[model samples]
Target: MITEQKPLHSGYGPESTAQEIVSDQDLRGKTAIVTGGHGGIGLETTRALVGAGATVIVGARSVDRAREILASLPNVEVIRLDLMDPNSVEAFAKAFMNSGRALDLLILNAGVSFPPELKDARGFDTHFATNYLGHFQLTLRLWEALKRSGNARVVALSSIGHMIGPIDFDDLHFNKRPYDKNISYGESKTACSLFAVELDRRGQEYGVRAFAVHPGAILSGLVRHLSNEDLAEWGVTRNVDGTYTSSGGFKTVEQGAATSVWCAVSPMLNGMGGVYCEDCDIAEVVSADSQLQYGVRPWAIDPTSAKKLWDISVELLNIQKDTIPNVGTNLDSDRLLNVSIEEPVVNGQLSFTR
Candidate 1:
């Protein structure tokens, strides 16, 4: 059975820091991997997990920089990984698989925000390729390691931006439609959520479960693409001291990583998976017309779309995995795209999990 999309009141809130969530727990002997774990909330996540005794491997594009950033930490290893490059992703997965280690936690923590329109080597939109497809490929390639644990969790860092749009199955790469950076980013995030929904459904039977998390808005490198005008419009301001401040609703980097850590290690979520979470708890499902600042949109969690996305992703990657069956027969792209109401006009102040 799928976990209901409702909060259990897990005794954690938006202000809860990642360290606070793991203070009582010990993760000795466990092995985990965090992509882009060298900086931002990913760094805090690595710290908390390592502090709890888990050996963490931080995947980064720059091995030297990652190692330098994490040099003070023990039991943490930094390896090279570039999400835009399929070969890099494959190599990283292969190295881990070679270790014969059981992966207890796999956090899909690396992602790109709104950047200039670009494409990967395969001519796929950079946002979709990097944020969703790359992580999807990595997760599948590590299936054996995850299953070895007999109890493993995979966390996909989704965002509130998912409400901006659902997956445009026919135009994922913006081939037909003119590319709007925010929409592309939103669709990628929605894909992340759907991936978790279907992945949990398939992996739960094998002792591997998946979760999609929305780490509340923190001022991180994710906003580097936004211009000063965009920042001011979003109620953010820069002071003479060169520091930034938000009018409200922004979280500290430590607080932002709490939910991902919680979903990864919290006993409160045992036997539950496939739910989109926020503020350290499973978020409520909000109607498309609702003007809520939080909660997940229905389109992001639709099971049919999730299965269709899985099949589409496999075909795009041209990989064969006999363990999971095909479920994308005669999928109607138009219907799936139209299932959710059009996005509402809002402040566009989305909380990023990366």
Candidate 2:
């Protein structure tokens, strides 16, 4: 378990940028996939990773725009992906598998918030579907490639909004309850944290680890739906200064990408998985009454809740019984075992034909 006694670094607060953390690191031959990597913090993340010699794949719903934005980068590729469409996810995974490439880092960073009520192609809540389930499916589909790298890390972007609510299993789709955007987005963010914890629990043994990140607040395209007045009401944007303050504290796009890149490449977190992180280190557990700040919430880090969420995800995605090649024959037993697929010897070279 991660302890709070670890000293905190003050210099790298809300204003730090991604280039600051990766200035001296070498990432040659590493391949990273960043969902929603075309704009905002995602763009900053891709830029930093590419600058450090890593080949970066930017997954976006708008391939043309992503291509145009990242055209100048030498090792960047843009692929089409819409989290709302499972078929799009499946096709993307198939293409990746066909390429026979191994993933060193997977950043599940794409998300939506507080949109008008709508259902996905599968008839599920749009926020929950795009924010959580889409990544869940993508992860499962890419399980083999991730395992092959032998030391892979996945970083899921959660949010401070998770503090607003707990997972509502019975009404996760928000069918019964009134459709409140904040509540729906909150539940999905909470689920993102839980997903990381549970994923680490299952994948740690295979050298695949997972972490959930709260990127801090930044005025990005994510707030396009919210009017200036709406943002001010949430205390996210200051009227006088005409600036945005994150829920915890405002962070630059680079600083927002720091924790994620840290979780991806930092040696300090080796052998540790399933933890929530911020400001380039493992986050501490905060109390219910404690002022909302830089640490993670209790529900976001609860192991029991993580497991429960995993079970529900399995049923919802219909993945409880599916098995990956050479990994195992039955996912039912493996699901219970939570085995890590990143065993060193496998290295993503196993043949699927048994």
Q: Against the unseen true structure, what C-alpha lDDT does each candidate score? A: 0.85, 0.75
Q: Candidate 2, after superposition: displacement of residue 315 in Å?
A: 1.3
Write model 2 residue lDDT over 98-181, tens digit each, in one string. 778999999998888767778764578877887888898788878877888999999999988888778898998877988888
Write out the backbone clash pairs for model 2. Answer: 16-255, 17-254, 17-255, 18-254, 148-347, 148-348, 202-338, 203-340, 206-342
TM-score of 1: 0.91
- By TM-score, who's the top model here? 1
| Deviation (Å) of 209 in candidate 2 | 0.4
Candidate 1, residues 1-354, lDDT tens digits: the string is 789999899889999999999999999999999998989999999999999999999888877878999999999987677777777676787788778899999999998899888887779997898889989878877777887898999999999999897899999999999999999999999999999999999888877889999998888768777778888987887656656888987999899999999999999999999999999999999997666779999999999999999999988877544433332223221222211223222222222238
Off by over 4 Å in 2: 1-11, 234-249, 324-354
- For each of the candidates, give the backbone clash count: 0, 9
